[model samples]
Target: MATNYNDYFKKNNDNDNNSNNTGGGFTPPELPNFLNKPIVWIIAILIVLAIFAKPFVVINQGEVGILSTTGKFDPEPLNAGMHFYIPIFQKVYVVDTKIHIINYKRIAEAGSMNDTRGGIKLYPSINVLDSRGLPVTIELTFGYRLNPKTAAQTIATYGFNWEDKIINPLVRDVVRNIVGRFPAEDLPIKRNQIATLINSKMQEKLDKLQSNPVILESVQLRQIILPNKIKDQILSVQVAKQQAQRVQYEVLKAKQEAQKRAALAQGMAEAKKIQAQGTAQAITIQANAQAKANKLISESLTPKLLQLKQIEVQGKFNEALKVNKNAQIFLTPGGVVPNLWINAKDKQKASVSK
Candidate 1:
């Protein structure tokens, strides 16, 4: 390292001079006169600087940089910041370690970067077959993050196109595999189940990635679309079921009304019978009381009582004559006649005259 440049240059110059003298077919390549100027050294320096600049990479925040030495990736990854490596012999590939969203939509979704709204809005979605072999389209969105621990492996496996190469393929395959377990009609209703299965299977699939694999955060099935014919069939079946239910309900209601009417009629008949029996008993009691009273009164009376009552009535008749002698009376049922009564002292003579 000490002053060996002089000896080294002297030896190289001697070899060149001897080669020229010996006259080999090989000749010293001549340099352009421009390259010999001062500007040429500056250009050479710039070229060296440019070559040296390749190793100094600026890894932004939320990024993980992997180094490839001589076309092979280094096991150790570089975090966000500036890093240096051997120029022309190595390269650094930056991986965004931030969480990434993988969205697929059919209906307009809120928080959509596309800003699309209702009406004829179609989006790219995953179409797969259900258990019935019917095609179903799923609109989904999920989140993921590159595992920093596996950053080197990720770069080696998918490089910069992990979404297309790894994430999407696994997602599509997992979704189809999971969704295929349900009937086409059930897919729309079983959206949550489908999403759960997809997430689980996707996580399982991601765990199998070359190195540390991607961390699958979540999976969601936003919308499910079935064939129009299937939807119509389902609707028709539902309508028919509703109609049948209504008919059954009406029949049940009619039966209940009939039962109620029968009960009412029976009750009315029973009440009438009770009322008639009570009335008959009351009338019999009244007739018996009247007959007993008449018997008692008859037993208490005698002939003497009868004679005295006649004498009293005669006295009343005499008083009545004194007041109104012209008053007429019926002597018998066959004729109207006048009173023939005289003084009670002349009873025998009055009798002879009548």
Candidate 2:
């Protein structure tokens, strides 16, 4: 270790003078002779090693090192793992390349409300005037990451204030501007569209800030706070729409039922018409059969059949003639049958003759 007096340059000058005065093969100054002891040399060598190793850095996974000389960031950057630089004349700034999550909402997870690990709640809600001139509060969370390819550009452009100066301000401006274009009722309906718009807008601004881009992975719109009256009105409108749909469905169902009954009635009427036609056809067939039988009988009649019929009538007349003297049975000259006859003039003459 250099003492306060030695650190001031006086001791360094004296050492250089003594080395010039030695006039021998380039022997180190008196300090070396004093440092000749094993322990002293060991300590000196260790100190020298430490100084050389001071600028050596092991950049872990997902980390990049930016070289800075005399407080000026170098254009070239170092990748992960072991690297070396000039000590006291140069320094390295380590930046994480992994994604960073920043939440600006107070809404918690399902169980925990105050978990600090969730995220830092900066300004929770963004107050904006919507399209309808109504005030709406939007709660949101956004994700970003330091671009690894152009580590030097990132460090040079924003250093460690990328989130505050570039990302945060741009987010506020884009989100507020976007939300203002939508009405209070439309905000919730267009939440996804709003988030995508904010992400794209913010990305455009952040990309312009540095050659290495800070990518916005996503933006989540948590909640839209609106007045209770507006919510109730929206609910009523939804209910009315539902009721109208139900009525339409019932009307359609009744129409279908009426169609079904009409089809049944049509089928029954057709069946009855068919039955009536069938009955008329049956009666016609029976009449045709009876006419055929009567024609056969009339064609088959003969003289012998007529004589048999006359004999039957004569027998019946004789049976009646036995009961009364004035009655007598007889046949015509051609053998035609005289069945029965009553004459008032013949009855008077017959009684006078008797």
Candidate 3:
């Protein structure tokens, strides 16, 4: 039976092979390649070239660039505009060339007006003596700017925190030194002069620093403080002095008025005396004129005028006798009338004598 089965299988295989040969033959389609190694390498090289090329950076107006080579400072600086630099090795720092302002105030430890903390706090108390050795408190403000060209040099010489190292110390020193020279009273009255002095001192100190990174523009005294008790005392004294001055002025005015009145009285007395003298002199002159006229008339009288005067007297006597009941008459031979007498008894008598 095994032999019969093997012969049957072999006969079936030969029959199938004969059938395929008699039928038409079939073929399979080919697939294309997606990626090649040379193409991939070319794309990578392009990407690397783009990154290595140095790119330009634009610096804006009113700005200066600080160039550094390999993390170190470059001797030359770049001005405002587009500038080229090594992408990996060179670095650029931009600094503003224009002026800048900063404001600082002194604060207390507990932040109160009078409280003070230890070790020179942000807003610290300053003690100074005046000409009178009185203690005073002072507050001040100042304006400053960074020097553009010397910024790097300043930082290099005085460390990166140059504002704290150079600026703060110099301002503190100048303020204290200037304030120390004056008294509490002068601080308010001479504030402008004090500011000028501080500014001059600050400039001198800045010049000595040699860094030239910071410039002191101006200094101002903002506030002046004094002990309350002392202030009150000074005010009271000033008031008393002013009152005394007012009294003195009133007295001076009164004295001037008195002097004017005295001068007027003296003038009136002098005028009256002159008028009396003038009146007396006029009376004397009139009396002298009348006496002269009387003397002239007496000197012109003569003997003929005397005889005429005698005859006129005799004629007046004769007229009188005719009306008189009692009359007496006497005549001389030189043309004089003889004596004649008429009595109340009706007796009449006449005498003729030589």
Candidate 4:
């Protein structure tokens, strides 16, 4: 039972050697005594970890890495991902390539470069003199981003404060130059033109700069603060224009109404004339038909037929005269027919006449 552990290991090693020699089995080489130490294994593991992990940086999205050796920046920028640098001899500077905004506003409460939200910087609204020497305030927002291709050169030339040197000054200068070209009263009216001019001028200047460090995304003109008297005058002009438009609309409406009434009256007069013409035409046609019928009757009459009609009328009158004794008859040139007749039935008058 208390057999020495060292003897057990030695015996096993001796058996392994014998098996390897006789049975032709392969044996592993023994490690050195120094290698058996736990500290040496731990040191090797740490060395491997340090090589892979230390003196490295992970560049996030929308960012580029600037590598500088001893104080000189590399021209080509490192893209987003892990980057390696030599210890103490090299360093990496992360420059943001994402779009950023600079808002020139009326208030100054919004902090400067320290603003953490989307790298937006705020400055006081630009105060400039108009062509008339009147004071004006200009409010606007500028959008831009560092050119990733020339990020290193941009940083080298302008440093980390590239926005101040490239963007801020350029924007202010362009705004002042463009705004000062016009009178204060015209600023609000020519806002769009002013914005276009400022954008083009700023972009032109930026492109002309060495290496073109910043890419101009947008330049928006938000507001133009004019003097109070100019504001009042503009307001008055707007009111006058509205009144003129209203008057023109009313005049047009009246003209339309008058035309409608005239049309209605003309339509009524035409209808009455057509109705009168139709009535006259109908009367004329009826009279012509009646006259034609009478002519036909007259043409169909003969002497014999007239005599027969006269005989029939005489017989009817004779019968009538027999019933009324006081009846009197008068004949015409055609004596077979009575032309006039009277019946007087007063008895006293009949006696007197008889």
Model 4, 246-276: lDDT tens per residue?
A: 9999999999999999999999999999999
Model 1, 81-183: lDDT tens digits are 8898877788788877877776776534445444433212223588888887888888888778888878887777776766667877787788788888888
lDDT of each: 0.74, 0.73, 0.66, 0.85
List pairs with backbone clashes in candidate 2.
none
Winner on lDDT (2 vs 4): 4
Best by lDDT: 4
Which tens-of-lDDT digit does each residue in 1-354 have in candidate 2?
544533444566666778778864464434544543467768988889888678599899888898889888877667878988888888988987776776665443423332335334355457778888888777787777777777677667776766666666777788789998988887777888888888777777776774845766778888888778778887898899999999999999999999999999999999999999999999999989989998988777688887887788777666766666566434467667554443333655432110
Best by TM-score: 4
TM-score of every prediction relative to native: 0.51, 0.62, 0.54, 0.76
Ten residues in sequence with the least summed lDDT for candidate 2: 345-354
User: What is the RMSD, in Å, between candidate 2 and the native fold over all Cα?
Assistant: 12.4
lDDT of 2: 0.73
TM-score of decoy 3:
0.54
lDDT, model 4, position 122? 78
Superposed on all Cα atoms, model 1 deviates from the true structure by an RMSD in Å of 15.6
Those runs of model 4 whose alpha carbons end farther than 4 Å from true positions after fitting are: 1-53, 111-116, 291-326, 335-339, 346-354
Local lDDT at 233 for model 1: 85
